[model samples]
Target: MTGRLWPRGLRARLLLTFVLVTVLGAAAAAWSSAGSASTALVTSTERRLTESIAGQIGAITPQLTYPPDQDALDRLRAAVGPDTLVTYRNLRSANGADTGLVTAALRAAVRTRKRLVAQRITAGGRPWLLVGIPIVITGPDGARTPSGIEVYAVRDLTGVDRQIDGLAWSAAGTAALALPPAVLLALLAARSVLRPVRELRDTARRLAAGDLAARSPPQGADELAELTVTINEMAESVQTSMATMRRLQADARRFAADVSHELRTPLSTLTAVVEVLATATAGMEADARESAQLAITETHRLVRLVEDLMEVSRFDAGTARLRREEVDVAGAVRDCLRARGWLDRVDLAAPEEVLLRLDRRRLDVIVANLVGNALRHGGPPVRVAVSASPEQVRIEVTDGGPGLPGDVVPRVFDRFYKADAARVRTPGSGLGLAIALENARLHGGDLTAGNARGGGARFVLRLPRNLEGA
Candidate 1:
């Protein structure tokens, strides 16, 4: 889902959204500003044109008489420009020409001696502004007459349409010039915000991959900094807790080792006394002899258990030292199987000489535990495989019995954790798989347990070829 991809992280998605919105808002503002400026320019240009034409007529009125000569009027209109046309009602008769685009209203204005102006009117099917002013005529007594000639001028405004086009092009040019910088700034801002989010994402992935010390770098005095600080603190807390647990686990392993060492001397003395009692058991009753033999066997099992526990404890305490040597992996498996009387039970599939640097005692412990577990609870005829790659050696032990209980599979290497508790109520200690795992780890290797496909358990051991500081 999109929600899964985005998450609730503040820095991830907001940066992109911010950039897009800012770009859109800037474009809108530029468009609106261009439109408003164009409107204002058009209105102001029209007003200026109106004032200029009115001023020109007012300034020329004193020099011109009513029913002025058409030649002088034509000269005045020619001075204005080709786009400007001037006409008068009485002058039209004097010139013997009809006034262009002039109506009867202009004649009335001439008779009343007044001015008339019309804006944005149609002339020759095109828009124009028409202005008319009455000219006063002086009589022999120098008195003004009630009736006067009307002079009108019509100016074409097609140039206004051209000016509007020019204004629109200018606005578009300005907006175009501004857009590149806006896009660049938006990209930079987006990257700045997304950087922190990318770092956080990588850190989260590292943490999930079991690197508990992963943390994000704090940036500024803002909400992002606060979040970074919080994530770093959480990582620190997790690291501290894991360290404490490892230390406690080491202490517990040391305690077990100490107890095993203390029991060694007494157990050796008990074994010697049991050996002496076995000689007299031949003259005793059958049940008494059987009981004595059972005690001795249990004592022997206890001795092996204590020794394995001590080795495991040594590994946990970081006190286990490896005696590394070049040895044939196949030979080791064969020897282990022979010692456990399981040579017939296991099918060895290996080369004649697959050499590896390993500690012999630790390797023996790993092999023995796997074989013993297969023999005891993994049914008959187990399969033992040994192979070697260029960098490591692999040992596999498989059985045909029912696989380990599903719930107990993950914790099989945990100390004292046992499945089928009711079936394993004897005096034997539950430290075989744990010791095997510890020994494998001590040798720079690993032991893994899983269900075999043919309805059984399978244990695999992988060890590095070069066991220098194992």
Candidate 2:
């Protein structure tokens, strides 16, 4: 899990990233601009100080003795202005400034007499500009040399510092004002990008929920639009495939119903003929009677196959409506076994008061098919158990035979599936379990087949007590 300080949404993250970058850049530019303006003002102040100091020293050279007198020093200070500090040194020239602020480097530069020298120093929390000028005099032989007098001037720069501070504040204000517009622009950008993504997400959800025709509409002409177009194409392909599959499934079901309906007349004729043959062949030769009975048996099996197929078709067509009513679940199971003449062939464990609202006829079919399947393919003692829970009724049909193979258990309810594909002879048409499962589902129930723990096949049917469709 991420910390709450991390944004959980895309829009917030985008907006934050934009603002952070903008703020950092603005801060850097502001600092740079303030530093540049402050340096320029300091440079200009130093220039004015140097020029004023040099001119004062030139003017004071005429009044100075070998060691300058107090009067000459005072004239120099007056020339440099009272707000500035003027000092004469090297020969005990006069000034009120402390000598400690002057370094040996300034004195040496002044001794060279090549150029004026300046330095910056801080005193009492205020910046000061200091300039050094060497006093020179002309010799009678037309040669010039230092006269051994040095003048220094100091200027306070408290006002320049204030101006620089104001510039910094102005820059900060400009950046602060940019925030609202940056956030607004970021929101607009985030909305435009996420709109298409949101739409695509919704479309994908609908498609997953089985609305195959769902599509994402394209927006913009960038990569996002291309993505939308691709999604739509994929959806269209899936829709086409599903539609084709449904058509094939419908055609197959229609063919089964058509064929089953078409065979009814012929099946009726065959039934009448078989009954007559059964009566006529009883006293005939033994071999002939066996053949005749085999024929009758096969014809009966065919009739059952056709009927099961028709029932399955009705389910496929969704015409198998449930006729639900309040019915005793135990009594229904007992009656189903008794009607099939299997009362003595199976074990019954049921509670007498277990009741449910279900289609009794479908229930009967489900029970009979399960019992008959056990008798045909599984070993005894077959057990039919009827029970109930708070919200549902249950039926479990267990057989004592070796359980179905693991691979075949899940497919037992599939139409026309046989556990042994090579063994072609069985009393069943292979549709009994499929019909049973469909009938269970029509009553808002489900049937599942699996191996019982003690060893054998078990088929369980669970039905909601209050059925919805009747």
Candidate 3:
């Protein structure tokens, strides 16, 4: 039952759901952010590589002259760094020669008076960026003349790749740094959502346990607070209704006690007169004598009913007292069975010397009621058994009858709850089991009834064996 309450509850479900969603969302966000940052950093690195290559190629372009000048070519080659390449095409001979790394297409573009950027071209079994520049000389008429092209350069981007790797590591570090806070926030959010739901569950459990006044206090300005307020209102309504019911119950008990007390004296005098007439009716006609006997029996039943009601009222008013002492439970059960002349009719079993701290009179009442119930409604040959453990005493009454009806078993200990009609032939007040339950509770114990596995009804009473020790 406890497992069902927590695992099936809304608070636990919602907390789990929120935590899962937050963790997934945080992970997704981190992945997306890392991807975007990596892409932006890589693109920027590539752009810088392009710009650096272009700048170096442009700086050496103006220093080149036309008409196969070896001095200009040598100067260009010497001015360029080892990572840069210079290449020229001998258009007159349809031949290409170059210094450093240069592709055929770059040499061809220089010869054809076009500039080109050849990226990631293979050179000496390695990768390089080949930039081609065209040298244009102007005639006196401002016409363009193309001679040999010069100044092609290549820049190594190995350092750029290393910087990109560092940037990527940094981005990963940033993402890692963000996780702890996200986890903390997720935990807090889950707690905020679950706390009120937990309170509601606890309040609901207390209400089930008969504390109708239990309620949740509103906290924070959120939907959860509103839910708390709503639950509080519901608890208030329940508390009010329960208070009204208890007030009505108290009034009814008082009325029953007052009316019973008022009628007891008159009923006792009438009972005496009826008894005297019952003696004289022995000589009268058979029908008249039977009627008189029925009247006496009914009067006795009425007296017993009034007395039971008074006792119930006393318990209700908190005026019932127990003369507590250490006594043998087996002796009490035996005495009850012997006094009621039920020792021969029913099977009475007891442990030899099961001692308990209890009121002997109340114990007798408890045993008598359970035994009488078994004998009356529980077919015949009922069994009363007593057993004791280190902590508690257990008394069980089993009947071989049809057992209690399923629908009526739960309310059997309620006052005025008769399995049959109240005006029927049964010689018992329905308050017997109710009084027995009350007495058991007053002794800090409980009495419970259920169907036995072997097709009968069983009433089990449990009481603390040593109240003082407890």
Specify the highest-lDDT model's number: 2
lDDT digits (tens) for residues 267-298 of candidate 1? 99998988898788889899999999998888
TM-score for candidate 1, please give it.
0.61
Q: In angstroms, how far off is 61's CA in candidate 3? A: 7.8
Instruction: Decide which is better by TM-score, 2 or 3.
Output: 3
Stretch of 10 with least lDDT, candidate 1: 90-99
Q: List the residue pairs that clash in candidate 3.
A: 85-154
Q: What's the lDDT for all of these models?
A: 0.74, 0.82, 0.76
Give residue 142's error in model 3 in angstroms. Answer: 12
Cα-based lDDT at residue 88, candidate 2: 49
lDDT of model number 3: 0.76
- Which pairs in model 2 have colliding backbones? none
- 1 against 2, candidate with superior TM-score: 2
What local lDDT does model 3 show for residue 378? 83
Give stretches of model 2 more than 4 Å off: 1-162, 187-221, 228-232, 264-304, 334-349, 367-385, 396-437, 447-460, 468-470
Q: How do the candidates rank by lDDT, highest first?
A: 2, 3, 1
